[model samples]
Target chain A: MTKKLNVAVVGATGAVGSKMMEKLVERNFPIETIKFLASARSAGKTIEFNGTQYKIEEATPESFEGVDVALFSAGGSVSEVLAPEAAKRGAIVIDNTSHFRMDPEVPLVVPEVNRHVLKTIPKGIIANPNCSTIQMVAALQPIREKFGLTKIIVSTYQAVSGSGIAAIEELREQSAQWEAGKNVEANVLPVKSDVKHYPIARNVIPQIDKFTDNGFTYEEMKMINETKKIMEAPGMKVAATCVRVPVVSGHSESVYIEVEQETTVQEIFEVLKAAPGITLQDDITQQLYPMPIFAENEEATFVGRIRQDLDNKKGFHLWIVSDNLLKGAALNSIQIAEALLEDNIL
Target chain B: MTKKLNVAVVGATGAVGSKMMEKLVERNFPIETIKFLASARSAGKTIEFNGTQYKIEEATPESFEGVDVALFSAGGSVSEVLAPEAAKRGAIVIDNTSHFRMDPEVPLVVPEVNRHVLKTIPKGIIANPNCSTIQMVAALQPIREKFGLTKIIVSTYQAVSGSGIAAIEELREQSAQWEAGKNVEANVLPVKSDVKHYPIARNVIPQIDKFTDNGFTYEEMKMINETKKIMEAPGMKVAATCVRVPVVSGHSESVYIEVEQETTVQEIFEVLKAAPGITLQDDITQQLYPMPIFAENEEATFVGRIRQDLDNKKGFHLWIVSDNLLKGAALNSIQIAEALLEDNIL
Candidate 1:
């Protein structure tokens, strides 16, 4: 018989947090007792999960008293204050924020790629990779292992929902305004906290997060730094150019990779076909490939449009798509909790 | 004063041909006499150009009787027949279709990059490079002249207008349907004649044109082959992945290049600043970068978001955008006509 664990979902009312609730039920995660935690403002709210209504509680240090596993998606600030507290209370923390991802102690993980890191939870915390990073690494890991990846150059066509619910609402409202022949307004896109906002309804913005000192956005850096950490290839060369499209759910990527070992396009296809958590969608004759609308609610990371470079036999190109809310966030966090239970860590 | 010449606009009722009329007037091309030519279906219709109305004539070989310079924007079949016929009749034919782009005897031209190629038109015909290739080679020419480009990998975010006006109408209708909470239909996007059609109002399609053998789409191959021809570098290694986004006019590209000489991002900025027909909009502190919505109806190719590769010192990444209808098509054709006149080839 399987053991049922107590699970606490932090930031249960936000975009990713709400999706976490849906995924937890859909995946039939082993749960004995469930609690929804949010900021004090949303404490009195009631959320229904698995056909049962649960009253939201304000997340404080004391909320982790009886929790066996806690999933944190409440921004970085929330995780910074409460993750360690939850850990101190003997609960395993799977943080979805960027706060502890780069910390040497916290294991930045994509469960399929690096679940072994869950063996030793030094800080009693595991970090979920970024939405863009999760899908790419998950698709690339199998290829990397088979062909030996040396370099990656990726350009992302990210959906607006990766920024959260307000950005999704902005896209919907701006899309409506475009249809009405009115001037589309922008209040919350390309980072709500940034001083300048661009209308993403009929446009594509290149900046995702705020610019760092090295001329890359924070979002780009997360993909670069986290991929190296999760893949445990410190010398692997990764470059990312992240852009926000008007899509509401799935994030798509055009990835170019150069492998160390000599490989053919057929070999790459065979490896991806046998890999876990990937659906190979590359049939050019039928015009079958992954698109954001089709990938909206799917769990698998979909990849297609694989082609070899005309000049260099070692170089290959691919298009990868996945639902940013599912494989990219909430479901990934829940999977980490499952991995913990499967590994006998909790 | 420059000599005015008789000019015929073929496919004048179509998208690019209509824009050719506007661009000729906007740039004030030296015109002695102008005539509009179209298929039998559009013949006898009148189009107003520069406040003057001209009757559209059915395009036959006989239509080029006294024309001195003919601009062909019709489909490839029309160009394949009419271009050589017009050229044989002593009219300089500048063809916009893909019929003659890769013809060894026909010079593929982007005026800013390779105006010298106009000196000798062996077939008495000049081919306008593909829309996506025109803007990229124009921006890269000066950089290549200074630093010597060795390799290029590009992924494009193209607009619906590149597929002609019907695809544009479909996107608008789909936007309205999305706003009404109705099932959005797809009829003319990705490729109108292809077996599958996908929604583009809030989606991005990775395939443009049809797929060729070796798995690269014809659009991708055009970008690869045309760049080598226009830049006159047969050995330049290039790969492209073209995708269609929701925008209606401008085409944007995320381009990565490796140069033989060492260069800094600041030096590349300086080269772009001094280059012709390019606007450098890459100030990170000001949150300024080129976007398709802002680049619509603009004449200059906008380049920004320049960054050096974190690992390879010689590799650099850039974002390039331009109005596909203008610089990528009509304006470039008009510029080629002007170059021919200036070089005494017409």
Candidate 2:
């Protein structure tokens, strides 16, 4: 018999937070009690879970008092303050924000790639990798394990929903504006807090987040650094060019990787076919490949268009697509808690 | 004083063909007389050029009898038959179709990058490089010329307009479908005649053209093979992953390059600033980078987001954007004609 535990969902009204609720219910997590927490503005809202209504509560330190596990997807600042508080209250925190991901003590995890690191939760928190990083590593870990990856250069076509519900709404509105031949207004995308905003509808913006000193966006750096941390390959070379496309959900990546050993496209396909949490969709004859519209609700990391580089025998190119809200954020956070439960950690 | 030459515009009803008409008028190509030619289905339709209406003629070898310069944007099959016929009748054919691009005797030209190749036209036909390849090579040529070039890896965010005016209509219709909560119908994109069609509204399709035996689409192969040919470096290592996004006009590319010489990001910027036919829009401080929407209808190839690879000093990353119909196709074809006029070849 499985043990039931008290669960708390932070930022319950936000995009990823709501997705966490759906995944928790769909996955049939063993929960004795569940509470929805959000910012003060959304505290009075009622959310339906498991056919029962629960009033959303403002997430303070005390809100996590009786929680055994807490999933955090509230923005980085919210998690920065509340994650430590939740952890201090004896709830294992699985954060989906970028705040604690690079902390030496907080384990940045993708369960299929590096679940063993959950053994030592020094800060009592496991950081969920970035949406773009999660899908790339999930699809590549299998290939990396079989062939040994030495270098990765990834260019991302990320969905707008990765920015949150506001950006998704903006995309919807801008598309309408474009259809009407009106000016496509942008208020929430590229980065809401960034000084400049661009219409993502019918456009691709190369800058995902604010630029770092090294000329990489914070979003690009997260994919670079978190990939190294999760893959446990500090010496491996990784570079990313993250762009925000008009997509509403799934993130697509054109990834070029070089392996340490020789491998064929067929061998790589076979490895991805047998890997956990990956769906191989690479049959060129039938025109079968991954597209974001079809991958929106899927949990698996979908990979296709695998081709060996013409000039370099050791290099290969692949297209990976996964729902940014699912595997990239909410679902990954829940998987961390599930891993904890399966290992008898909670 | 410039010598005016008789010009023939083939496939004048098509997307690139209409753009060729616009470019010819805008550039004031020293024209004695101009005629519009199209397939039988489109014949007898009248098109306006320079405020004068010309009846579209069914293109045949006789259409080029007195024409000194012919620009062909008709499909490949049409070009395969008519381009040779047109060239044989003393019209120097600037073929925009892929039929003659790989022909060893035909000069595959991007006027800014390889106008020198126009000195010899053994086949009496000068081939316009693929649209995607033209923008990429136009941006990379300056860097390659200053620093010896070695390798290129490009992933494209292509516009639906590259497919044709039908794709543009499809994207517009699909956006309306998505807005109305209807199932988005796709009939024209990815490839019109290919086995599969995918929605380009809020979705990115990885396969651009028909897949070849090497698992690369013909579009990707064109970028790879044509870049080597246009750059005149037969041994240059180039790999391309072409994708179609929902943008209406401009094509955006995330390009990674390895140069034979060590170069700083500032040095590359300097080279691009001094280069012809390129506008350097890469001021990170002002949040300025080339984007598809802004690059639409522009003549210059826009380059930005220049960054040196953190792992390799010799490797660098760049974002290149250009109006696919302008610099990528029609304008480039006209530029080839202009180069011929400048060099007294026509």
Each model's fnat?
0.76, 0.93
Query: Candidate 2 docking: what grade?
Result: high
Over A1-346, each residue of candidate 2 has an lDDT whose tens digit, in order, gives: 1899999998888899889989998999999999999899999999998789999999899999999999988888999999999999999999988999999999998999999999999989999999999999999999999999999999999999999999999999998888888998889888898899999989999989899998999999999999999999999999999999999999999999999999999999899989999999998998899999899989999999999999999999999999999999999988889899888888
The best candidate by DockQ is 2
- Give lDDT tens digits, candidate 1, residues A32-102: 99999999998999999999999999999999999999999999999999999999999999999999999
| Residues B162-236 of candidate 2: C-alpha lDDT, one tens digit per residue | 999999999999998888899989899888998778899989999888999999999999999999999889999
In candidate 1, what are the lDDT values of residues B1-346, reduced to their tens digit? Answer: 2799999999887778889998898888999999999899989999999999889999899999899999999889999889989988889999999999999999999888888888888988999989999999999999999999999999999999999999889988998888888999999989988999999977889999999989999999999999998888889999999999998889999999999999999999999999999999998998999999999889999999999999999999999999999899999999999999888877
Model 2, C-alpha of B76: deviation from truth (Å) = 0.7
- TM-scores for the candidates: 0.99, 0.99
Runs of candidate 2 with Cα error greater than 4 angstroms are none
**Chain B vs. true chain B: TM-score per candidate:** 0.99, 0.99
DockQ of each: 0.83, 0.93
Candidate 1 error regions (>4 Å): none
Pairs that clash in candidate 2: none
Query: With candidate 1 superimposed using the best TM-score fit, by how many Å does residue B213's alpha carbon deviate from the native?
Result: 0.8
Interface RMSD of each: 0.8, 0.6
Candidate 1, clashing residue pairs? none
